[model samples]
Target: MSATEEAMNRRIVLARRPEGEPGVEDFRLEAGPVPEPGPGEMLCRTLYLSVDPYMRGRMNAGPSYAPSVGLGDVMVGGSVSRVLASRLEGYVPGDLVAGFNGWQDYALSDGTRIRRVDPELAPPPAFLGALGMTGLTAYVGLFDIADPQPGETVAVAAAAGAVGSMVVQLATLRGCRVVAIAGSPAKCGYLREVLGADVALDYHDPNFPETLEAACPQGIDVYFENVGGAVFEAVLPLLNIGARVPVCGQIAHYNDSGNPLPGPDSLPRLMMWVLGRRLRMQGFIVGDHLDRLPDFVREMGGWLREGRIRHYEDIVDGLENAPAAFIDMLRGGNLGKRLIRVVPEDAAGA
Candidate 1:
C-alpha cells in the first residue's frame, strides 16, 4: 500500500547543476497526482532511496560515463520500492522490488527495470547495500581486478564507506592484510575494530604517508582506489613491484569545482612511477561488471544469511530531507551506506 491516503506524489527534482558541492537549493520539492500504471507497467511506492557519490557526476552539465540528469527531472538513483498496482505478469500489489525508481515517492515501471526483492534472509535495504550493487562493486574491484592472494597486503581508501567497507572485509576473509584509509578518526576506528582491518589510518593525519608506509611494511600489493586525491599521492610510493590498483571511484574530488585535477605535470611522474614500480592501474565502471552479479549474490547472500558479513545504513528520515542528506553524504558526513527513507519499513519486514 502507498504511505498515505492522499493522491499526491512528492519528489525532489534537480533544479540546477551544481558548480562545486551541491546545495539544497539545487534541488526543488514538488508534488503532483500519483501516477497510474500503464499497460504492461506497474506503479511502485518508494521505500528507500540511495544517495551515492556517483549521482554527483550525473548532476553536472557535461557528459560522463552516464547521461546527466536533465533539469527539473526527478534525480537519478536506485531505490527499494513496493508494487502498488500492476498490469504486468509475475508482479502484484504488495510485492517488493529494487529498481531505478529515482527520487520520487511513486514511479511507474514497465517490468523491464524492476527486480523482485527477496527479503527472507535480509531486509529490503540490503538490496541497495551489501547484498546488492554495492557488494557486487566490491567483489568486482577486488577479486576481478586486484586478485588478492593469501598474505598479500591490501590498502583501501574510503574504508568506512559502503563499497570500501565491503572491500576491507572481503580482502580480510581472503587472508590478506588490510590497511584502511578514511577521512576521520572515527571511520578509521570503525575500519580497524569493526571490519577487522589490520591497520587503519586517518587521511587527515599530517604524517599519513609515513603512517601508511609503516602499516604495510611488506609494501602494498593491492591498492583499492576510491578516494583518489592526496590519498592517491600518498599510496604511490608504497606500491610493491607488480602491484595492482583498481580505480573504482574518486570521491575526494567529487565535490571539487572545475577540472578534478589541475597542473598535471604530475602525470609524467606517475608514469615514471608506474614504470619503475611495474604497477597495473586500471579504472572500472561497475556497469561493465554486471556479468558478475549472480556470483556476488550467491556468495554475499550466503555470507549475509550466516551473519558473516556486516552492513549498515545511515538512513535519513522522510522524502523531503533527501537533498540535504545527499549534500551531507558527499561531504563525508555519512557513517555508512547513506539512504533516504521515503516510507518507513513495515514492522513485519518488507
Candidate 2:
C-alpha cells in the first residue's frame, strides 16, 4: 500500500452486546491503513455519523425491524461522507453522499443506494438530520398516518427531540394546536419558544398528568407516540374519541431487557379504552413508508426553506464518543438529533 493510504482509517466495533443499557465497554476503537477504491466502488471519508435510539434495539440479540449488530462487527449507522477516491461511474472524488456507512472513518460503497447530497442545498450534517431520516419520520408519521386537521389538538411525546420537534412545527403549520411533552423544563422551554408549540409540559413534573389534561382540554386528536412507557400511560387518558396514534418509537423502553415491570398490569384497561374510544393505534418503521419519501422530500424541504420548520442537533466529537452519546440519548441527555463528527471531511467547505 502507498504511504499516503496508510494515514487515515479508524473504526468502532461492537465488542460485546449489552444485556440492557450499552456502555463504553461494549465498543472498541481501532485504527488501520486507509482503504483503496476497488472496481465499481468508491472510498468515502465520513463527515457525520448519526446516533439514534433505534440503535439500542439493534444492540440486543432479538428480532426487530432491523437486524441486530453482531458481536465484533462494526457498529451500524447512517453517515454523511465525501468521496475521497472513486472507481464508480457516476461519482467523482469530491462528491458528497449519504448512506449506511457504519461507524468508521472510511467506508467503501458500490454506489447502488447512495444518495448524492448537494452541499449547495444544505450543509453536510443536515444530511444526517433535518433533511434526512429524522425529518422523514416526523413528516410521514404526522401527515400520512395521524392526519391532524385544523383546530385539532396534537400531542407529541419527546417533543424536543429531532423527530418530535419536526412533529410540533409541522402540526403547528397545519393550524393544529401543538402540545409538547419533553423531559425537562429547559427542553419544554425550547419547544414553546423556538418551535412555536402552543403548550409545552415537562414529563418529569409530578403533576404532569394534570398538566397534559389541562393542555388538551379538547382532548388529543393526534398523539405522536415516541416514548412508550409512562409517557404513553399519561397520554392514554387524554386521547379523544377516534384519536389517531402513529407509534413512531419507544425510547422509554429501549433500554429495558424486555422484562415486564412489577405493577398492576395496565393492558386490560388500555384495551378497554382502545375499544371504547375507537382509537386508531398503529406502529410503523420508516421503511414501511418508502413510497412517501419523495413526498416528504418535496414538502418538508419547502417547509424548511420557508422557515416554517426548524431543526436542532447535539453533536458529539469523534467516533470514539458514539457509545456514550448513544447511551445518553436514551436518558434524554441530548436535546435534538445526536450526531458524532467522525472526520473532517467537509471542514474546508463548511
Model 2 residue 88 lDDT?
Answer: 94
* Candidate 1: C-alpha RMSD after superposition: 1.9
lDDT by residue (1-350, candidate 1, tens digit) is 64344568898999988888889999999999888787898888899999999999999888689999999999989999988888988898889999898999889999865777899968999899997777888999999999999999999988898899899999998999999888899898888888899999998899998898889889999999988889999999999999999998999788777776546798889999999999999999988988887788889989888877899999999989999999888888887789998987672122
Per lDDT, the best of the predicted structures is: 1
Give candidates' CA RMSD values in order. Answer: 1.9, 2.0
Candidates' C-alpha lDDT: 0.88, 0.85
Candidate 1 at residue 65, lDDT?
93
| Candidate 1 residue pairs in backbone clash | none
Q: In candidate 2, which residue pairs clash? A: none
At residue 68, what lDDT does model 1 achieve? 94
Q: Tell me how far the alpha carbon of residue 232 in candidate 1 is from the true structure, in angstroms, after superposition.
A: 0.7
